[model samples]
Target chain A: MHVTSSVRPPLITGGKTYADVTEDICRQVEGKPTKEWKIAFTISVIVLAYGTACLFWTWWEGLGVWGLNKTVGWAWDITNFVWWVGIGHAGTLISAILLLFRQKWRTSINRAAEAMTIFAVLCAASFILMHMGRPWLAYWALPLPNAFGSLWVNFNSPLVWDVFAISTYFSVSLVFWYIGLIPDLATIRDRAQNKVSRYIYGTLAMGWNGSAKTWARYEYISLILAGLSTPLVLSVHTIVSMDFATSVIPGWHTTIFPPYFVAGAIFSGFAMVQNLMLITRVVYRLEDYITLEHIESMNKVITLTGSIVGVAYLTEFFIAWYSGVEYESYAFINRATGPYWWAYWTMMTCNVISPQLFWSRSIRRSVTWTFFISVIVNIGMWFERFVIIVTSLHRDYLPSSWAMFSPTMYDIGDYIFSFGFFFTLFLLFSKYLPVINMAEVKSVIRSSSEKLPAKVAGVAKGERVANPTFNKDAE
Target chain B: MADLHGKYLVGVYDDDEVILHAISKIRKAGVKISEVYSPFAIHGMDEALGHSRTRIGIAAFMFGVTGCICALCLTIWTMGIDWPMIVGGKDPISIPNYIPVTFELTVLFTAFGMVGTFLVTNNLGPGVNPNMFDPRSTDNKFVMAIELGKNKLTEEQISQVLKDSGAEEVNIKQF
Candidate 1:
């Protein structure tokens, strides 16, 4: 039986029945796109068009259009890559980790979050391709055998590990998200009035009849996927961090990179989720499904992960001095007081100091504050990666070779391209798909809904047996 | 496409808990249930229908094992046995360095394998028309279908049993 604590606020308000859940979630998919959606879509497409042109010219001109010097080979490309990849982590965390934890609130937001993961990874992968001077030779990164050579991709290289990690993560996340969508798609299919809509949704639904045996197997497979994904998500960022950590650079070669990067990933990821979801909740009028409780719960996660990232930053600094290596110590000192100190301090203020505001219950629950800070956290996270990659390389060993890096229009445009691509995909998904997991939410209605009478609510306080069939009128 | 051909008695209920209780009652009355469909998965309905636990987890484990083995073989065969080359000043057969790729491939194989097995076993795939008892079953209704050929009870008797066991509506469905 479904059981939830009485002290906790109702996960679903408005006393939604199974039919209401279906109606509320499916309305967006079945109905016409709103004016706001049209406007947003137009803007995103325009940005995507301009950015694509810049990206095409960058590739056509052979990476010379961007500001990459001999001293600093990596710049906004790798930074944006890590930043977008980190943003993708929140989706898996909400879907897989929260599923394992049995968080019922995740039912409302997990679909959109997981979609975000897929699109964010696509944006991140775009950066990888853009960074590769010859995008056609990108397959060389894979471990495919060549007809002319005995050299396989180096298994010892973290870059090779990244190829495997990212591809696996993308495919697995896509499968998991699609599997979860089948039942909901069937719901929409069954309700569709138009023949074409019915046929399209019917195909996507895959003939899901909701048989008891199939449901049993479906639940089991979902659990197994979640189990596999937890470690997979952690491993992805760990491997990504190892790309730098395994290097011999004084600031990059640190033992703490794995945990540090993972925490930072979840931190930035939650902030991105907050930003997208807050807008989605308002634009779609999904305040009932994505309630204030969900917002507060996600804010708490942002706080916890943000704190871990803060500690990691300080720990890196202390260790730099504690290691007594002059190069390592100088790297940390230069990061705080170097020419790129604005970026470093911006990272500190946005990521470390900003999320601390969530400690106040009001601020955590306030939509305005949450949205504002989420934007700040995203900016800070981008700078965090920029600081690590650029500062470490900009002033490496020899003074004669040291140089400051600046981004040309191409670098800025490529970064904007990701934003354009991500928003374009997300807007389409929200417009055409059920943003909430209807079946999962319906299952919890008996236990977590606010339709219980006063007496039943009192009885259910601090105890089980909340009476599953309490609200006959609700059905 | 004509996987199901049957004349059946369909019982519709609104609440999951009520249908769950009705399943045991109807079965106790000696009527065999062909299937029960609902918008959401009803807990304990499988046990109430006397279905044993599914073995998809076992398949998942086996797939995971296969993935692990394949990853290990790929790394070892390519890095060590095929062409031994020293990269990053490490051994060609370094297992520690192989851990990340090995772990990733294991998860990838397990996820794809398990989902493939699940879809295949459920007879679910794109463009497959579902054998539906009631359209509302996907909306708000819990539909219990009893194949007339499998059940020993008369249609009238089965309808009465369904009505008495809390089915809001009972009807005959032919496919």
Candidate 2:
């Protein structure tokens, strides 16, 4: 059944020691890159250079240089924004939310996912700034109140709301991620082989030592932050959804957006995780740490969220049809049967149908097959945004306002450049930072003993339980 | 250094089931466990550990309420008191009209307030680093710690107590 390989830590029958896990992860940094890394890095650099040149050109010109007319004011810019933001959501979801839920399986991939979130958000913000026609005047989006005195900025605009939400999310996620990195950085510092490595690692470590007392407060604060970050993570996407929901656009103004967008964000985020993890596990031979069981768990989330998004899709259609507003009805109908029907169906097949395969045990566990499906999930999400944005806007209230829209090479270039920006940061993370949470992995190993008596009071298997130990010696 | 001897308590378990079991035994033994240590997060440990429902939600409620109030004040001051511009055929302070701004204020203030509250409650900011123990505590281990008061035994007695309670390794710290 290949179930054994799926359980991973391959032959963890005796359970892997903490030292083994640390040694396994540290091997990548301690050794030279495999042949594949050299090739991949070279390609990424070239692509990154292309992306930089595109950005320079975009800045030299104006947002009008792209194909965005007044009809499709957002075009690839907002699509890329939402896409990258969606990509970033999985980071805090995996690290912060999963930590709050006490999901043991999350430890394997949370570090990498959080790194991806930071990079993806950076990419997303680049789009936002670049899309600002007058990039120098982008501060108008902030709440500084126009200096030229064109009346104080409305406090109610979702566009302004997006500024706070995205910025807060970026900062909070960065803090959450860095706090988790402290001990692992110390681990690298302690074990570093060279003077330069030691100096760099030490600075990042911020003088951490393994004392039991400090750990007490650290644990308390982490729990609190996890609590804080869970809602914050949820809020980031909810606010992002409001960016569309508050708008009077035919397809955008729906109550279903918050939950639907949240689900889709997670769905796409996990898909990206799968994409990166699959290649990483294969290339770095970290299948032991990033196991098939972990993939299955993530696939389960992807599938569940995908199904929720599917319901949202159908619900929007149903609501629009039932509302009997011709414009609204036209939006859905045009999406499904119009010239861009290919985009809509592609969204459905990739995001909705591809994930449904996880309903089967076999499909979810097959590493190779899951990787293929993850690509489909990514493509589906990107197309879904395109369908939602372009289809609804191409034709508005009157037939006289209708016009067909197609992305020019400029549009395509800007979209592709986001990938360049995303990967460049990602490659840097892979090269420098500890991609896995080493401390957490060690703790997992320490607590994996089977000899202890079974069945304590009310502690569930694999769930986050509070600490329960009293000192009789004190009493 | 501080003198907090023999007061700290911890129960160690190898697996989740044992963690739950040890929790039961420890509770039954009338020994208030300062902490429970495990390799992974076992479910329901918070209830087992005697932790209160954290005030984070309450703080969020307060933050959200503050936002609503701020929105009200800002609208009253800016639109009602200041030069009222009747641009959209509506009163500035009207409920229907004020909703969008109110909502935005609610989000903005709640988000910022929650962040500030969180930072303060956690005792986090620049130049204030908390002491650390077992660098591994936040990593892979699920631990519950309780620092003891004045009454306590010798390190050997405490060590024996922890070892009997299934602690894999029992140690002491005087701070």
Candidate 3:
């Protein structure tokens, strides 16, 4: 009954079986940390320690420690916030959007990507807290009955919408992720060799027994969650874009921001996913699961979204010029020819130009080239935010108040802090949890695995021979 | 963990296809199946086992409606009725601005509510131990359990039917 196109290359290689899938994925969770993992973990912890200290001082010394002036009140903090939030989008896109589209290749990478999403969103939220100078009064952003008066939060404000959007996104994604993890957790629980691991994984598994009734419900809920999440993901970035779009600033106010920002978010998010997954694939020896075909497929997405982002940039400039508003025209011209031209050009080259290289099949399939481009894409994305936020604000209508913004050490340190925090959380997750979704992978192995030879494939022809490897010694 | 106190015949299957076929053959032989468990969800196995489609979708839709109504009530009550201050000179009750929050709350409620209902219905929660017929059911095996008392066939007859229908191993489970 499980039919697949013979022309399509195998998603899972090495002719693996059900037992092998469990063994291969579970070994990483059950085994001791490899030397490479120890080294990587130690480095992450060191970076986190330094970042925490810098973050502490930033909180202690206050906003003056950053390079924020009246002209550029929102520099590195908002840029980092947007950047991290954009990175979080890829996880939801892969898990929810791809699920709806029936993209089977997503099974190999969705677990780790969703984890990345959660951690990235956490990092993004940290920036919002950090930007609020008086972090203690953060709860005032919420709609609460105030003691001062009967006043409530302004429901019309985009910032309040952000508060709702981000919190809802975080909580819903967490639930979706945990729901997906239950069956795989049960697998780990059943295979645990020690009492501690057994007890721990047991509680986390929530007593999943893989009954037909439970699986039926599980699939149903997963589909509904995916349906809910598609629009949720789009709305998150749309609301983020509205934060600037609703403003009256020359460059900030644009009708195209919602779609443009969403495209750019997915573009940057995929780049981040590629970076993390490539490193993870190598470190965990997961080449069989995260195959080259998977890498190539991701590259194709990168090219498509990157092209869309590129088109948006061109359209923004075209609309700015065609609208004939002197302020908006000046903003676009200044972005290309102003004091911040270096940042603008960097954004163009990195975001608009670099991902186009993925058009070549050889380069798309090359691990070295992909990793190098992914890093470049991330740098470009960060610069894109900087150009949009800083350039638009630096030269206000009044020439007397115009000033250039430059980051102090504290600004740089805070950005580093998010990086440190993200990696540290990611490393811990990789070490402790099953990076690959075991049960989901087992299900797909029947239709997408490498075909077995006739000698090893004991089943009759025309019946589904799901990568049968009856001769275990052949491996 | 609920103590299982029944005698049952458990047939272990190595492949999902074999188990799926076995469900119909064993049912045709007049033996009622108690449950079938597997490492992964076997497509069509639910229908083969004669289970009707789940109603979780209806529950999710209801939760979503509740969320939409709640969001509308919160916005209308706070922004329109309660001491409304006109900041940008727009109307005190702005439905356009309300769309984002309304949409967000709807999704939030639907996701959490449906998941909560799923957990409660499936009898799943943290620290709740499940009655696993075979531990390997979470690994690679497909296990079919039948309460011996409920079935009309003898143990030997049922075991023969299971073997003929492609069960690799047959065992007695006392819960």
**Highest-lDDT candidate:** 1
| Tens-digit lDDT string for candidate 1 (B1-175) | 2323498999998667778878888999999999999888877878889999999888989999999999999999999988888887888899999999999999999999999999999999998999999999989999999988786778889999999877889988998
Q: lDDT of all predictions, in order shown?
A: 0.91, 0.69, 0.89
Pick by DockQ: 2 or 3, better one: 3
Instruction: Point out where model 2 deviates above 4 Å.
Output: A1-14, A32-34, A447-475, B1-175
TM-score of each model's chain B: 0.95, 0.75, 0.95
lDDT of 1 by residue, A351-424 (tens): 99999999999999999999999999999999999999999999969999999999999999999899899999
Error of 2 at A303 (Å): 0.7
Error of 3 at A275 (Å): 0.8
Docking verdict class for candidate 2:
incorrect
lDDT, residue A60, model 3: 95
State which candidate has the highest DockQ: 1
- The segments of candidate 3 whose C-alpha lies over 4 angstroms from its true place after superposition are A148-150, A452-475, B1-5
Q: Arrange candidates by lDDT, descending.
A: 1, 3, 2
